[model samples]
Each structure stands twice: as C-alpha cells, then as structure tokens.
Target: MADRRARIVLVTLSDSFSSTIEAMAQDAALAIDRWTPEGDQSWPDATAAVWLLAGGEETAALDLLAELPTNGASVFVIGSSTDHRVAAALLKGGASDYFALPGDADVVRRTLDRLVQQEGERQAADSFADAERGSVGFASVIGESAAIRRVVEQAKRVARHDNVTILIEGETGTGKEVLARAIHYHGPRAAGPFVEVNCTAIPDNLIESELFGHERGSFTGAIAAKQGLFELAHGGTLLLDEIGHLPIELQAKLLRALETREIRRVGGTKTRAVDVRVMAATHVRLAQAVARGEFREDLFYRLNVVSLRVPPLRDREGDVELLAGRFVSDLATRHGLPTPALSPEVLSALRGHPWPGNVRELRNAIERALVLSPPGTLELEQLWLERDDIPAGDRAHSLLPFPAPLENIIRAAVAAMVELTRGNKSEAARMLGISRPRLQRWLSEDTNEPTDQ
Candidate 1:
C-alpha cells in the first residue's frame, strides 16, 4: 500500500523483519511504501524517508546508499536491537537518525516528524536561494580571511544586545546586509522578522511615508492606509542600507521614532508603539557627511552606538578565489548543470585583480562565465570584465582628455576628485597640489572669466 504522508522502504535481509517493520510503520501513522531488493532501487517520494538495515551488508549498501539523492530530503535508518554496530554504520552512512527496532510506535512517529521538519527546512533553503538575491543566516559572509573573521566575531558579540543599533560602513558590495542578518538571526531577536529597506532606492519625497507609513489621503497617490517598515519590523531588526542617503527631513522623524519607541503615521493622529533594532549601512563616509551638514549629527550619533566596517574584497587577501569557487558551485547547482571546473588562470586573474565592486561583482562575473563558457571547465578567456581588466585609478586618469584648456581641465579634475572623495574638499585640494582656499576660489571663480590661452 502506497501512502502519501511519509515513505518507508524496508531493506531487511529477512521477510519477517520487513513484515514487522511495515506493521509498525502502519500503526505509527507513517507510510510503508514498498519493499525493495538491494539492487537498482529508488525510495518513494515522501516527506520523511527511512532505510532499515541489519549490518554486514556494508559493501552492497554503501554503493546503493551513495546513489540516493540527498538534496531536499531527510534520511533515517532503523536497525535491529542487537545490531548496535549496524546503528553506528548507518549513521556514518548519512542517515539523519538511527534507531533500534522494534522501535516504540511513539518513537517512530516522533522520528518521522523530526525528519519531516528537517525536510521542510531543506526545501525552504532551496527556495530562498532561488528566489532571493542572497541567503540570510544560512550562508556566512563568505570569506575566511582574518578581516572577515574579525567582523564575524564582532557581529556575534554585538548580536547579544537586545536594543543596540548597529552601523555597518564599507565600500559598495562589501556585504553589509550579510553581516546585518548574522547579527539579527544570531542575536536576541532571532525569532522576529528581519526587514531591509534601501534608503537610496526610495525617492526623497516618499521616504518619510515609507519609514513611518501613512493613512489614506495623507498625500497624492496614497489612496489607502499603509503600514511602513517600522511597523513591519516590529520586535525585530530593520536594516537601512545606504542610510547616509536618507533625506534630511526624514532623518529627524527617524531619530524621533528611535528615541521615543513610537511612530505616528502621516495624516493620522494616533501614535503606535514599536520595538525595533536599527542596523544602518552606507557606502558614503558618514562622518564627513555629518561634518559637511549633509547628514544629521544626532542621528549619526544614535546609530553609531556600535559601528562595524566590512573590509572591501581587495583588502581581504585570498577571499576572491574562495568566493569564486563558492559562487561557481552554487550557480551550477542552481542551474541544474554539472559543476564546471575552474582553471588556475581563472583563479589567478580573479585574485590578482582588485575587486572594486567586491563580492557582489565577483558573483556576477562567475555567473556570466558559467553561462558563456563551454560545458566542461571555465578558462580565463571566458570571464567578462568591463572595469576589472583595467586598473580603476588608471581609468580615472585616462578619462581626462588632453588638449583642452588647462583651466577647464583643472576645474573638471577638481570636480571629479571631489565626487570621488565624497566631497572632501581638503582631500580634493591636496590631490590638486594647491591651497584649500585657492581651490575653492578657482571653483568659485566665474567659468566665463576671460582666460589666457
């Protein structure tokens, strides 16, 4: 009789043992799907699956067991009470749980339930990998370098706090959100929701409402009452990526929300209480921004309670190779293709280059390589690099056109430097080899002023 709830295949050497196992499974509310010979067999599709064994068949069973698909499945083994050796052997053979039979009906049922739960988790992981841009809690930040290890350790320590806000600062593609999830899932609020909002993605005008929500008719196009990220992340962690980009108007309200532990929706009189931990990340140099009046001083102080900086991939030596292999294996598995081998030159070029875009960029490179390369292995020629092929600093110098007026060129250089350094006037002036005031005067000078050729 085939049952759909759970599947069990008895592979015992004796007919009596198989009969006993089948009867016990039926009583325990598990499905005894079939009895199969040791050769050329596959387990039935079910939530929880188990294999029964009695030792001494290691040679035959090992080959058969290795052939079973372990992905998205929970496996267990049942052994005879006297076959203690068999229990150990089955466990070593990759069975999730090993038990001696005739196992109690309740114990059997409980084991089945546990395996089913595990199977569900496996399926969830698969879904997450396919659906989301990245994995949370399950995948680590993906570098074994000392820099990454230090960040991971600090995150673990910070996660112990119940209400402390964390500020993660780093260059773009430095994996700030990955560390943020590590803190949330490993921290005191592990059971709560982990919500992320990209401050840069939302328009300046809509930001306030996005964070605090609004009642119907509060603004044009807001036809219905809405819950904001604060409400959505109640009793959990909310990650504000590119937080330095948050407009000044919304910054004040965010600070108020954090300080008062309450929020008032736009066009609504009622204030609702919320308990959420804030984790802010930025590619911008926020200290410089605060000094320049672009970012709020009080908000900066509030979020800087515990600051973590993720080192760029270039700074973390050997991380590129490690990450490339991981990405290659993962992408292949996801696409349902055989894992392609990576050549030495591929690894060397990946490591030698400074990944300005960091891990996210490397992942894109590998995914492209996997798609474009021949079926067997990935060679250096297959990798596509727009910026990686040329040094970034070199490219910056190359962008400047020659034969243009020196004054116009100087002004252009200054502007580029200012933007590159995130508007650090002092750094820009130093790079131009001029006094800060002189640089300012030049920028302040009329471009239309008659100049000596």
Candidate 2:
C-alpha cells in the first residue's frame, strides 16, 4: 500500500492550469505527477494522496475518476459545469470534492486542511485497534453452562474464518458484544482492529455517513472527506450492535457492502475495498422484523450466514450462582472492596430469582451490594434485588412458588413424600406411584451427599 500522503496526481488538459497545480504541490512540499490521459486509461504504479480531474466530458471524467488509482487517496473534480446534477453525478461516482472552478478554489483549500485534521483521528483509531488485539478472547466470555458452552464452541469454530459473516441473536445484556469481541480477538484477525458500532445510537440521517463516510461537500454540512466505520475497521472485525435497528433504506447498501466487500462513500463516485469481517448482533428477533417488513429479507439472509443465539440467564440452569460469584469477585476488586464470603442465603436468592435483565442485571446488583455493604461485609439486604429476591422454601414458608420449574416441583413433592414416610423409600415410592429405583435416581440427581443415599 502506498503512503496516501506521498504526492498529488494531476489529470488535466490545460497546460497553464497544470503548471499552477504543480506550483501548489511544490508549496505543500509534495511531488506532482501530471498526465494528459492521451487516450490511455492506465495509471498503474502511481501513488498519490489526491488526484485533480479537470476539463473532461462528464462521462469521460466520471469514468476516469472511477479508474483512478486509490491507495486511500482523495479525488477532487474541478470544472466550469454549473449543472447541479453534474456535480451530484461526479460526487456519486466517488469524487472526494467537486469544485465548480474557479470560484470554489477556497473551499478546495479548506477541504485539504480538514483532511489533515482528520488524519490525527484516523491514526488514533488505528492505534486503539492495535492495542485491543490479544486483550480479549473466549476467556473473557466466562461461562460454564452447557447452553453458553455450546455457543462458545460454535463461536470458536467460526472465529478462524474471519471472512464469514455471523449473526448473533440474544436478549439485551446477554453479553452479545462480549462474544463477538471474543471471537474477533481470538480469531485469525486478532492482530487487526475490533470495532463496534451501535446501529441505534446514531441518528437515522447520519448513520449512512457514519458507516460509509462522505465526499467533501457531498451534503450540506459535509465540508470534508470523512472515512466511515467500514474504512476504519478495514482488515478487522466490525460488530454492528443492535443491527435490527438499522434503517430499512440503508439495509440494501449494507447488503451490497457485505456481498462485495466494497463500500462507496456517501455522495462519492468510487467504491473503496475493505477487508473486514462483519458481525451483526441484535436483541430483536430479525425474522420477526423481516416478517413485519421492517427489515429486509435479503439483508437478513446475508447477515444470517452463520447464526448463533445466546441463551438468556433463566434458561441457563446452574449458571446463576457461578455468574453471581464471578461478578461479586470482579466487582468487589474493581470497587476496592474486600471480598466477602458468598453466603448460602445469597446463592439461594440469586439462583431462584429470574434475571430478566440477564447477566448484566446480576452484575449490577452485585455492584450495588458491594457499594451498600460495609467495608468487609455483603449482607442480603444490601443486595436489594427482586421484590421477593429470596426463595420461599427457606423453612419459613417452605412453599415452592407457583410457575416454578417442573423439576423443582417434582423434587419438592418427592422430598415431602419421603419425609411423610419417615425415610421409607419403598413406601414413599408406592405413595408417589413410582418405582423405588426411580425415586433413588431422582434423589441422586438432586445430590450425592450421604443423606440423600
């Protein structure tokens, strides 16, 4: 890749204009390569940060601009045409700036200065990406439940295939981005950037520019050429979070970019090649969105190349306690609080509460507890979770709540029956209308403690 800041290329028919352009390049301490085109369309081995297109027919100028060598170079089209459509067409063809010379010369100068200002952000973004490499992976998405393990297994398998588009579907706060990051940071492109953008966060009008940049003066306020997220995330992973919120109008463009690995800047005439792996994640079910005509079917299909659904917290049996403990440990350390023993009451309360907000809510509750607790203690009251965060069957009521898991109801019944029979397994089985061996098996599934046997 040529350094885009190296020099300027002039494609012009006016000798005087070319000489003046050469003088400006000299003023900027940049080398200039002038060409008359001469019916030849090739400019191979040319490296320039900016190209000047002057004095050509509309079709020819657009074609020439489209074929111009691009190593992240900006193109400026200058001519006397006052037709608004001509400038629009040139910009749509990827001209970074269309100056209706000779009155727009000052605007062009300002655009160049703006490009210089943007270079600083570009460098910082790239450096940030480099720093993120190797800082996260599958380990960061900590979970041992079979449900989570299954998702992790699939993510790991597909992580190496960075070119394959992936769709991650899950509820909010289910750590969808964490999984996406783990896949990217541990994948073959770990050395590349890991960029994430929330589709809903940007306004509808500006999202197009945010994702696909814009040519200078392409729109009313587009004073300078700007690189979009796709350009910034080149050669890495770009996670479009909450993708279902992406506007239907722009979905076609997204699909095209995904299908072609190329994106044209907003109001630009040329397509820029981007080598990036895309991961689209949404809390809203996209199929439902498609059915509602809110999301494009083709775009959904394109993004759903490899779909993975992260299970919600309630469905992930036996993971609540594990996650709660982990959150306590992590949050405590971060808040500079001493780690307190996770009491059986706290564990029981955590396991029984259905986490509607999922892992994120659990973590927040733990953080709240840590803050509300004394320097070395984590009391149940400080947790202040669900209205009835504590389970009912804690010797006071000992009544399993309604709509409890069938298995828990079954266990409660069996335990009650065995106690009613005074530990007589055979009698209890007969009363429950089940075989003694089955009763014993259920008990064993419940626990391996000596008392269960």
Candidate 3:
C-alpha cells in the first residue's frame, strides 16, 4: 500500500462498479490493484490511495469497517443499497463518502480521476524550529528602522516553518525580492535552489506552460518536454515576483497547486507531487484588484498566510544617509574609483530628498554621483537625484503623460511639486502659482493616497 502509485483496492461484489473502474483503468493506463480480504485480511497495509468497500452483507461490512483504522490516511468510499442503518454505521465509522451504486458512479469516477492526476501530499508534520541556514543569510538586508527591523524579525520567525506560504507586499523598489531571498537562505532549504519568476515579464499565452511545464509535442512549439519554474524550484523556493499580474485564468490552478502540493503537466494525463516553498511578492494592492474583478479572492487568502510589508525609503527615517554612504563606498570600490566623502551639505540634500523608487533608486543615484564626481571628491552638483527632482517650471511638461485626464495631469503636477519642495506645501504652491487652500484641495483629492492631506 506504500507503493506510491495511484491504485484502488476493492472489497465489493458490485460487478457494475468494478467493470466501470476496469474500463477506466484500461483506457487511462492506470494501475488498478485488487487485494483479497483476509479472514485474516489485515487492514490494507492502509497506505493505499483509496479503499472501495461494498456492504455485501451489512453485518460483515460494518464489523470489518469497525476493525479497520479509517483515519484520513486513505479515502474510503462505500456503496450501500442495503440497510439504511448499516450505511449510517459505515459513515460514522470513518467512511468519507456513502453513495448508491451506478447512479453515483460518476462521483466515484471523478474522485479516481483526481487521484490519478495528482498524488497525495506527503508533507512532514514534525517541527523544523532548529532549521539549518546557508553560508549567506539576512546580513544583506541592511536597515535600522523599526519598520524594516520588524519585517526582518517576522521573516526569521517564519523561516523555521519552511512549508508555510508567504506574501510580501511593498512598493516597486522596496526590496521585496531581497527579503524573499533572506527567508530562503535562512531556512532549512538553504542548500536547495532559489528560483524566481516575474509573472509580468512572461507573455500571457505562455505563462501556463512556463509555470506548470509541458509534455513533448503538447503544443505548436513544444517540441521537447520542459519543466516549469515550479518544478525547477523543487526542494527549494519559488518567488513569484509581481504576482498580482498573474493571469486570472491561472489563479484557480495556482490555488489548487498550493493546497494540494501537486501539479500536472500541460498535456500529461497524470499529476505529480512537488515540494517547493512558495512566496508571492507584489507591489499592487490585490484587494483593489479583487474588487475590480481582476484577481481571485480565494487565491488572495491562500497566499496571505504571512504578510510582510517593506517600508518605502521615504518612511525609514535615518536609512537614507546610511544607505547612500554604503552604496557610494561599495560602488566606488567595485568600479576602482577612490572613495569620496559625502560632505555635510551633500548629506543634508540626500537626507532631505524623497526617494520615490526606494533603495534601488538610491543605489543608482550613488553610482551615478560617484561616476560623475572627481576621483576623490563628491559634491551635490554631481548628484542629480532624479529627473523628477527638477523644479516645476523647468520639467513641468516632461512629467505629464498628456492624452491623460486633466485631473491626472493636475495630480502629477501636485505630486511633483510636493516632492520638489520636500512636502513644503507653501513653497510648492508658490512655485506652481496656486493658493495654499487650492494646493490642499488638490492633495486631498488624490485617490491613491487620501492620507497625503
């Protein structure tokens, strides 16, 4: 019974049900094993995929069922047309399902089909509280704010329970991927591979085959069988980056895979078991998407077991100076340039500016500044920060996407002015030729951030 294949053993005299199953097995090339009931017939090694019991004699069936341990280790289906009392007894004695023969044969067939497609999930229930870590770990997540520190501590706590799914939420450049890597390397699955798939980057038509693989000749271009990112990540982690962009059609399949720990090849007839810790990272607000009818609610709850939000760079108080210094030193060293000092004025400017793109943009700014500055000196002039940093009159036209709604253009202008003035609405209004009350009205109307007021 521990044979690890989809096989059903029967203890019934229903020729119709057995014949139907036999025909299905032959057509589908499935393994159908029949074991003789022992007067000494011990409980099916009890490791079989399914046990089909028929109450030929109600008393004998009830007695046999009582003697067997029908805990959820196996699926038990009993067909009873005999005593209603006997049927009740079987169900109470751990029979998962009770159905009359032939009429309910379709249900029986469907259950077998699902079993044949995917194996039972075989996850270890033992605790992994003392999981081992890889050589490289969380040291890469550099930050001192309580915002980021709390995220790191939460990650470390869940790292020990490697099988739990995680949802990482943040703005585009807020280091969601970096946090995902930290979770994987610090857990027991450190030695296994770490695979990443950007759901947005893949074409919509090919994403299914890309995530769930395909059999040879399954489609026009599938000349050879290929394993998907999920299978490639077996025994390790699979980070579905930009997960909110995953197609709506595939959302249900994804939910089933997560729940069952199994997946089927694109054109294959059977399902296969997989052991991969899944992590979904998204910058999009999935709840809003669900409201828009673009994402599935069930799938959202499935992946939301542990949510960790990475704070935007603007929110992490003193991290800008530290991060900029580290980036400058590291980038300079990597490019073989002398390490330059960030003067007091330059540091003040760096700290005062808002980093819309978070740490990624900060790193790029430091590298650009290092490359533009003289070998041993860094000045504020050498750091452009970003093109958006230009004043309203100088870069106003460049910010608008045009063809956009008048409100949208106004919104962008207001946001740019706010960033340009470092949240100084008075100065921003003066530059934009708008009154203080008007600026407040514009900020209040911002839908994405009502709290900006």
Candidate 4:
C-alpha cells in the first residue's frame, strides 16, 4: 500500500523564504511542488492545488488572491508581522486562510489540517447524489394533539412534491424551524440542502446579497465572491425565518425570483436558474401586513401557497404535559442520568399557566430547571412562574352574578368546562354529567348567565 500524500504549491520571489515555506510544509507531512518566478509562466497549468503564497504588497497579494480558482482550495500567506492587514485583504479576496509565516508551527499545521479536512468534506458533499428521497430522516417534532396532528398531516401531504412554497404561521417560541427541517427531510428535495436564512437578523443593506448571492467586486467591501441562500439551497428548501421584517424593496426582488425561478448575482451579468422550495415563517400577522400595504400583496400570495398554522402551546391542549415529560427524559438522557419524575405540583403549575412564549419557552424552562437542579425529580421551584402570573382563579365569567347556591355552582362548573374546552358542548356536558341538549340550552341562554371579567 502506498502512503497517501497531499499536494501544495509554494510561491515566493525569495529563495530563502520559499525554501523555509517548503520545508515547513514538508514538516507538516504535505508534499510541495514549488513554482519559481520563471515557472510561473505556466500558471494556468497549476490548476489542482492548495497554494502557499509569500506576502508582497497588499494590492499585489489581493490581486493574486483574486486570480486564484474559486473551487475548494486555500491560500496561506506569510511575511511581515503587519501581515494581519494582508490577511484581511486576502480574506476579502476569497482566501480560505491568511497567516504571517515563521510564527507558530503547531497553529499553522492545524490550519493546514483544517483546510484539508474542509476540502474532504466539500468533496464528499459534492459527490452525494441529488436524489429527492436519498434518506428519510426526521427532526425532533413531537406532538399528538388534534391541532398539532392536523398540522403534521398537512406537512406530510405537502412534502410529497417539490417547489411548493409553504407559509408557517406561529406565535414566537414555537419551533417553526424544527417543522421546516422535518418537511425538508421528508420532502422530494431531501437529499439537497436545507438552508436557513433569518431575514430579520440580516441588515437591510446586506439582505439582497445574502439571499441572492454576490459576484466578486460586487460592492466596495465585497472583495470576494459569495454564494447566497438560494444558490446553496438549489434543489432543496430555503427557510426564510422572520420574513415579515424583510424590506419592501427586497420583497419585490424575492417575489420576482419566486415567479421566474432564477436570480442574477449582485453585479454579475449572468442569471442562474435555481430550484428551491421557499418555506417562510413569521410571528407577525402577514395578512394584516398586506392589508396595511406594508407587505406586497403579490408576494404574499406567492409565499402563502399553503399555510400551516402551528398551534401555540396554550392552545395545544394536553401537549404541555407530553412535551414537559419528553423534555425531561431527553435532558436526562443527554446528561447520562436516570429520567426524573415530574411532581403533581409541577405538572399542575405548568398546565395551569399560559405559556406566552409557547413551546420554545417551555423547553428553555425545562432545560434551565434540569441544569440548575440535581438529577432527582424536577421540582416546582425549579420552574420559573410567578404565583400571581398563573391563571389559577382569573377567568372571564358572565356579568350577571349567580346566587351562591348548589344550582349556581353546577352551572358555573359546566360553563367553566365549556370555556376551558373552547365551546365544545359535548365535552362540557361530559365533564358535568349532563346531556348535550341541556348544556346547549345553558350556553344558549346567556341572558341569565353571570357576567364577570
């Protein structure tokens, strides 16, 4: 068996500097092919390579970096200690790494090692076949409530096709990204990429290039070429999170791309065709935005091809208990300990309180509790809900006060059950041991009902 060797291209005008670089590279177990000043005449032939260029003037180093190939290869520059500026220029010029030579052997060796590892990973990623159903993997999206189950059913139905835009509407703290990943992994473009771009986090000035990509020298600071979400997510899914915050101008361009299935890089003459399913999510009400003329109506229609509303934790009946238990068990397993029990008081507190932050908040609370408390049962004190905040006794009641009697108590219980279950008369009747028609009559006769807020 032959030893696997790595190829390196060392370039420097000075022989001593070039020799030092070549020796250092060889010491790191990489084979070098030095390109002298005269041999540079055939620079075009030096195609397959990882370059190690000795530093020159900042402008010259940047020019050299720009001329290098765009494929997965790195450039390591060495020279004066002030080469930090040169390194910055190189990075802006699309160099994978920049370093001042004759410094730390261990750190330089690690940098080279990382470059080789990244190259290997990129090659492996490229070699993967772009089959729609290459693998069936699902993220941690667990829920069985009727509301959540219906949403999951809709997701499964939509995942069968590719390029169908989906709008996921949910309150903040709901796992919109988790559901998005689940859709992508199970969809026709599963083998492709699942790229996420947070529209709100990106600055207004940079949103365009971030979403659609940019060509080299596209702007003053854009010294290197950059691939945006749409290009990287080709044949896959692009999750535009917090999309409601996108500027009106960028929204117009996004709508155009959605309609045309192509995007022109920021300063490039050529338009590239892409096949990506756009799944956008927002805590804000997009319909209201359209009505207010804040969001474009055409773009709204384009993105809202299919809407899946993720139920908030408060509305997702019985899911709190299920999710809390699941989180506890998951946290226990992750910590390599026995699954702890949730006390009745803790369950009561969790169920009784309205989770304004939804499932996300719940997970955070649980994780915080687990981390703070020892491995025993998670206690009520570990959870952070103020006693006053719990909706223990504050519920809306009819204004007409009921007499403090047995009949009134029964009516209150039945009415409370009906309100708690969101006007499900049958469930109210079952809870009160009364017939459906009786409960219906009770609800219909709001005239005699007590009114108290």
Give all candidates' CA lDDT scores. Answer: 0.70, 0.77, 0.73, 0.71
Which lDDT tens digits does candidate 3 get at residues 1-453? 445455555655344356666675556445665654555555454343545556355455556654554333333545557456655565555444455566656655665665565443221101121242332367778889888888999999999888999999999788899899889988888766678898876788999999998764479976444567787677889999999999999999999999999887686544667899999999998888889999899999999999999999999988888888888888989999999988999899889888776888777667767877888778687676545556668685546667898997898888777765567787667555457777887878877545542
Q: Which ten residues in a row have the lowest lDDT in candidate 2?
A: 389-398
TM-score for each candidate, following the candidate numbering? 0.58, 0.68, 0.60, 0.60
The residue-by-residue lDDT of candidate 1 on 70-152, one tens digit each, is 33343445444545565455545544445555644356555555444544554564355344423455256788889988988
Model 4 compared with the native: what TM-score?
Answer: 0.60
After TM-score superposition, the amount by which residue 315's alpha carbon in candidate 1 deviates from its true location, in angstroms, is: 1.1
Clashing residue pairs for model 3 = 38-41, 117-271
- Greater-TM-score candidate between 1 and 4: 4
Q: Clashes per prediction?
A: 0, 6, 2, 9
Error of 2 at 337 (Å): 3.5
Residues 1-453, candidate 4: write the lDDT tens digits: 743445677666334356666666676666566554445454433223455455444466566655654243345555544545555566656554455555544555665564455445434554553432333233366777798888888888998878789999998878788788788888777767778887866779998999987754579986445567887787778999988989998898999899999887786645667889999999889999999988999999999999998889888888999999999998888987668889889899999989877887787668767876877767677676653343644543532246677666656666766664456577556544357776766655556554332
List the candidate 3 regions with Cα displacement exceeding 4 Å. 1-136, 386-394, 401-453
Ranking by lDDT: 2, 3, 4, 1
Model 4, residue 54: C-alpha shift (Å): 24
Q: 2 or 4: which has the higher TM-score? A: 2
Q: CA shift at 18, candidate 2, in angstroms?
A: 11
**Could you say which candidate leads in TM-score?**
2
